[model samples]
Target: MYLGIDIGTSGVKAAVIDEQDRSVAEAAAPLAVSRPRPQWAEQRPQDWWRAVELTLDALAADSPAAMAAVKAIGLSGQMLGVTLLDRADRPLRPALLWNDGRAGAECRELERRFHDFTERVGCRPMPGFPAPKLLWLARHEPAALDRACRVLLAKDYVRLCLTGEAASDRADSSATLLMDTAGGDWDDALLAACGIARTMMPRLVDSAEIAGIVRAELAARWRLPAGTPVAGGGGDNMCAGIGVGAVRSGDAYIGLGTSGVYFVANDRFIPSRFAGMHTHRHAVAALYCQQAVVLSAGASLAWVGGLLRAPDLSSLMAEVEAAELIPAETPVFTPYLGGERTPHDDPTLTATFSGLTHETSPLALVQAVMEGVAMALADGHEALIESGARVGEVRLTGGGARSTLWARLVAAALGIPLRLQPHAQTGPALGAARLARQSVGGPLIAASGSEAIIVPVEPSLREQLLQKRALFRRHLHLSR
Candidate 1:
């Protein structure tokens, strides 16, 4: 058996996989993610650790045999979250989340400082990336930055807390926008451009490489055997790819989480200077993958659901899906609930529910929200293709994948088939499980599971969505 744990934004999930790559036992525990201020999201590193400990204990309690059967432990987690830790492995400040947009000025400064070395930084200038967050701390929270310690992301912090060894995986480090996506090493030139020393980084390792075992005290407290091998796991998105058998070249994953993404796996690195697409190595092996993130995807429907105060999410989607939305109407939505990541990478962008009148029903409004998100994802997909990456059929996952209407609309907007997965799990925990199996010389990919599939079914809606998408482009406005 292998243990796979996902350190997520709102929770932690631990799963024990049997020899057959099936989850024999699993447990999840939720934690609080705070948005203390607008455009600023933070979480304590301890929260993720505690969530992991509790979930692990629960899993062990449920299956005593799992304790001895576990051969290796793997991790998957939220990407781009910034955690500053001291030499003693203590957190000096709250970790900045992936969605936080407080580093705008810092990002601009970085762009100015690294005009000559932009290509070395792995990706384009984006406010939510870790480098800018580090700059933000250096400028605004200098004491915290000066505490003289390592800066790690969410999963790396969890690895440090468990093993007392600060380390990072290629997949997670890719999100920092600081990794040499092509070279597969930390770009010292980019690090220097950010004014940070090399010592500040943790030891880099492959996703499958074993980092360390559980510390004795914690292992005993969590009722686990000592010296359990903890495999280096990729960032959540990469893990998702692993979970769905997207390990080979040309395999693609279209994630519809809070943000939407069209991820394509490639054998070699592909750079897009204008498209701003991410060129990062695959967490499982030597090949690289290019991922394009839409600023807001599932977030649009979630926001609308909350506004409606719908008792159940599925009911809300169904209710909206049953309604008819006129194609001629130009209801433009930017889907910028939390700002955006791909193409524009703008924080000043605001959302709109334009082309609205008293005649627009609540259900129609909901349909419009889903359509808007689909259009945004299509925009990212097109930009990436324009940047010269070969586009292929998209495999879908995440909460938004549950909506048949949304998936078909997105498919039509992108004019590609959107096939679903066996399980619609977007959690990195599953990804970690897939990685754990791969590390031990199990199956090289995760294609033989109880996977599900969703194909496009609505052409009329697709045509309407395509037209609305064009109108949305015409109306897109950015203040900065």
Candidate 2:
């Protein structure tokens, strides 16, 4: 038996899985974020450690019988967050999240400095990446930066707190936009561009390799075996890719969380000419993935529900469903309420709602949020497919995938089948658990008996949604 932990923006989830890939027990603890300033998202690394503790404690309590059987632990976490630590291993400052845009100017500087080595490094400059956040720290928080002795991604930080060792793996490192996409190592030119040296980074390893064991003090505190192995896990997306049988090259997946990411796995490096998406090495050796991000996904629905004062998502979604309108029926909405990340990648763009009339109902607002998110993901799918990646049928995960209404709309608009993995949730943890099983057992990835089916929708509504999406794109610039 082993444990798999996933540290996400929303929460930390822990699952205890047997060698047979059966999840015997599971636990989770929610997390919250703080926005001290607009366009900046920060989370205390301590909160994650606590979440991990609570989850593990709950699991241990639920079934004390599994405790002695536990052998290894695997981790998966949000990507591109920067957590700085002092010489004594204390957090130097709040973590800068993947969604933050404070490093835009720094990203431009990096592009200028490394124009010649862009392709070799595996990425172009982006304000949302980890290295840019480091540059931002160097410029604005130099004092904190100077005092910081080590830098870790969100999951690695939690790992250090448990194991007393600072380390990272390739999958999360690639998200920093600092690695050689082809070679699976840090790019020297990217280092020069960021004015950072290799020493500043943690030792890199494969995702399933043993990172370290839980330290004696922490193990004692948690009442666990001191030498329990902790394996290096990759970013949530890649690990989630592992959770599904998408470990092989050319396998693709679509994840819908607060934001959405469309992923396609590969055995070789693939870079995007446009900055709309990211290319990275997979936790699995010689594998890579192209991931396109949509800035607002389930968040759009949450916002709509709050704005309409709906008590729950069902109520809001029901309202949206009741007022279904065609392109000829109502108006247009550019769903840039949150700064866009995919095809547009525009920070200055704000969401726009056109065609609102005196007859507009709260239902219309709800529908816009739903349809807007669908449109955003549709645009991402188009860009990813256009980039020459073989996007097979979609595999949907996250809160949005639970919407039968949404699944039909997205499938129709994209003209592809959307397969939902059986356990619509905890895909990453399942992936990590599989990786752990492989560490002692056999293969690095596996597919369970999870099943999915294609959703059905009226053909006319599908065409109408597609046409409305086109109209939204046209107005995106004309309104600008």
Error of 1 at 221 (Å): 4.5
Candidate 1 lDDT over 151-228, as tens digits, reads 888988888888888888877897787777666678787676665678999888889888878898877765567777
Error of 1 at 392 (Å): 2.6
Query: Model 2, stretches more than 4 Å misplaced?
Result: 220-226, 318-331, 446-450, 456-458, 478-480
Give each prediction's root-mean-square deviation over alpha carbons: 2.4, 2.3
Please give each candidate's TM-score.
Answer: 0.92, 0.93
**CA lDDT, every prediction?**
0.76, 0.77
lDDT score for candidate 1 against the true structure: 0.76
The Cα error of candidate 1 at residue 184, in Å, is 2.8
**Clash pairs detected, candidate 1:** 420-454, 421-452, 422-451, 422-452
Scored by lDDT, model 2 comes in at: 0.77
lDDT of 2 by residue, 1-480 (tens): 778899988889878877667678888998887779767878999999999989988877776778657778888898889988888888988898877767878877877766644586556667678877888888888898888778789999988988887788888788888787677788776665565677767888788888888888766555567688888888988888887667778888887777788889987677776747778888777788888887767766777788877898876676566666444555566666556778876655677787788887777766666677777788888888788888665687766777777777677766677787765578788777776666654566444545666565568877888788878888788434
